[model samples]
Target: MNPKNPYKIALVLLSLFLFGCKDSASIPSEEDLNAREQTPQEESNQRTTGPIDYGYGPGLLPLGDEKISNEPKIGFIYSCDTQLNGGGAFKAGEWINESEGYWDPNKKIMVDGDISWANAQFTLETKGTTREIKGNGLPINHNTGTYPISTQDEAYLYDRNPNSIKEQKVVLSLPVQPTLAATPRCASGMVAIALNGIAIFNGLDAGGKDAVAHEIQDQCDGHPQKDGQYHYHNLSNCLEDTPRDTEHSALVGYALDGFGLYGKKGENGKILTNADLDECHGHTHEIKWEGSLKNMYHYHATEEYPYTIGCFKGNINSENLSQPENNEKPSMGPPPTQP
Candidate 1:
């Protein structure tokens, strides 16, 4: 080979060796980004340490030693729409599937200008029958319920109006008249209200009998009752109202622990929203909630979640507390109306 050609080849080989030996920088790792994307637990801890002390709030002062109903029953008032299943079969959609639709803090389900009915079906379901116990005269029949009351008849008691809702109505019919005396009251000012926790634990159900109740937090322990039911505070104001807006957020009643209680049931559902994102940690974990796990009879508002005492009421928590003979009657109202 010629000397010049050999010299060029040797130079090219030297260049290639240099490039291969030199070190290259690596890309930034996920750990670095995670430091910026804070998790909900971290956020919760931060909120806890902040100025807002969520521990202390207005709670229903328990009156006296009461007992829960021996034969507790439950009822459900829901809206339905004709929908299609995967196999071309038509089915009725229940309100529980309308999670975002009903979780609205501003609206109320009213009927007959007295109480707003979230939907016409809610009026028919709850107007007559006790969700917890059956055969109380109020006709809560699923196949053929008779609730003629309508939004034309009732109105939302509380909306933007501050003073609209006062002591509201709650109809509960238990088997033994004596067992019906218990009414739910808030303990330590904290009602069974929750937003993030429920969003995370939504669709979780009890696996079997005596299984530990699944929830985001153990705040249920703070509740006045030993049953460990979680409920929201009731006020005369909207469920979204804070103590600053209203003097006291009355305790509503406990949120039931069941798959059907909240969340849209589906297979391979996408976790898109913030609530869905938080729930990813529990992926593939089945709903522990079964129909027979426990019998919880409670109530809330129809239009929106009841925030005030007069807007919604329940006899569940009170089942363990003693109510005066005169107050034993179900707290019924003229029907909810919107101002």
Candidate 2:
């Protein structure tokens, strides 16, 4: 890096071209080097790295049943103990027991261990010329207690008897084809959902504090709120990383407005920063869509502030998707103010 030694600079470039730094456990990927050299506004020839999924990526993957079933089944989950989920040893459309929530290693009792165990559905709503993908806000992941949630100064637990988790009628409707809006909208609570049917929330906690910064989350960086609804304030990195080329970003979920939500970095193992994103934390470029290449606008999560998304690039059906109980405003740990 010494300017006085031209050979040294040449050696550095040559080394990069031939081989990345030797000290790291892995070498820098080709795309990583290129993205670093270019600024976000500099017009990227860079494309998303993955084949188009038959369904959508992450949140909306597997369009519908790849094939229809003739089995005589009225409902999915069979009993009060059964839960519908596509994560953690359960495949898509499978039901498993969700009674035991996370263990309190210290107290040795299950926390947030509650479920309404009810039927949920997603249907297309068409009235006049409008279309939407509508369904309840209930998650298949059993709502677990995150009571005694720790904050900067104190930990607060909700009154379990009065505040309990229940099936929420949340409707989601996004255009089969999405269009970018002229302005970005704030991502409040319950901004989206994951493929597993879990809730995806905004980056801010009830107090506008960085939720990811202070909340004590389980392995997926998710926890239940006072009402026992489990959700994420960040990408959570919970989904198992599927295989793709080195420069590819994994689809994690979707924003309520129907935009694709991608993982924390570019294919090259580089940590994507806010600098690489717009005010809504996204960009437009070539992406793999339904097994083919399509140029489109999508959001990418960063490791920094507003880790998931800063705003929405497309119009959102807030009333349809926002958690009804959340309208009362969530807590910021005893400060007690409406958001």
Candidate 3:
């Protein structure tokens, strides 16, 4: 063979090798790229950093682990002040009928707003042995906080209550003279009806947490549930007859057991505390009963946890009871949004 011919052969071999390399170096396909395992850093980079979902509505998330007690909380006791979600306290202030347009998580005080209902009604009467309480469940005495908290309002960030304050057909016939049961029974759902015609739920919210502390309320300390039934978790300061210093608190409402629920004062006009009462948040004493003072077992409202009835001191008339929309069990999730 000629020398130049040999050189040409070598060049051809080199060219073939280069061409094979070029073919093997082709770019990977989209599927192959996606199939590869991602590194830790890359995986993190691909994830979105946003607010966590705690199975709660806007602003309804507790600041810490929720303080939920198992059912049969009849004798279970806890402090209301400590159950707060670190959100803030609802303080007494001028009514905020309009939205404020911003939410502040660090806000230490929660302001009140007005929720108007045109046909507010309530009545209390005693006929024979039955004390008939009737009303369209609306706060007839004072204005309530706006419901379905408007996105325009700052409270929306904390509580997006989607229900409106609709009137409920409430007619509860309780015994005029309730007698104590052999054993106190656990109470839930609509435990009582405020004198103003609003439903008074037990101290627990739907999630079994301290309702008054975790949930936001109107200036009147009232909010509506899923059924549009206006209700309270604690005694509303807006009640018709709240007695002052040295006077026994007036009869603000009655428990499902048909026992009168008095204000936060005991005899001799002393503001009561959990220490002052029994596990049911009351004590047997001579209170103004049906127009005359008589000694009986009655519940009392306090500025503490389990603010109202802790347990039923008397036999409850389940048939006459107006159950909450979610009456069977405490709701595990947040309330649904308004339609």
Report the alpha-carbon TM-score of model 2 versus the true structure.
0.53
Count of residue pairs whose backbone atoms collide, per candidate: 71, 9, 4
The runs of at least 3 residues in candidate 1 whose Cα sits more than 4 Å from the true structure, single-residue gaps closed, are 1-102, 113-233, 238-339
In model 3, the runs with Cα more than 4 Å from the true position are 1-112, 240-243, 325-339
Ranking by lDDT: 3, 2, 1
Collision pairs in model 3: 59-158, 80-305, 102-154, 145-218
Q: For residues 178-273, could you state the per-residue lDDT of candidate 2 as single tens digits?
A: 678776664555766654356777655443334444343443455655565666666643342323335446555667777778766554545565
Give the better candidate number (1 or 3) by TM-score.
3
Error of 1 at 104 (Å): 1.4
Off by over 4 Å in 2: 1-163, 226-228, 243-245, 267-269, 318-339
Report the CA-based lDDT of candidate 2 relative to the real structure: 0.43
How much lDDT does each candidate structure score? 0.18, 0.43, 0.55
* Per-residue lDDT of candidate 3, residues 1-339 (tens digit): 000000011221122111101122222222332232211110111111114222333322222124333333422433222332322222211221113322222222233454455567656666899977777887654556666566665554445566776767888889988999887776666778765567887766654455655566665567777777778877764553332355566666778889888777777667676678887788887665654557678888876566788777788787765456422122233333656
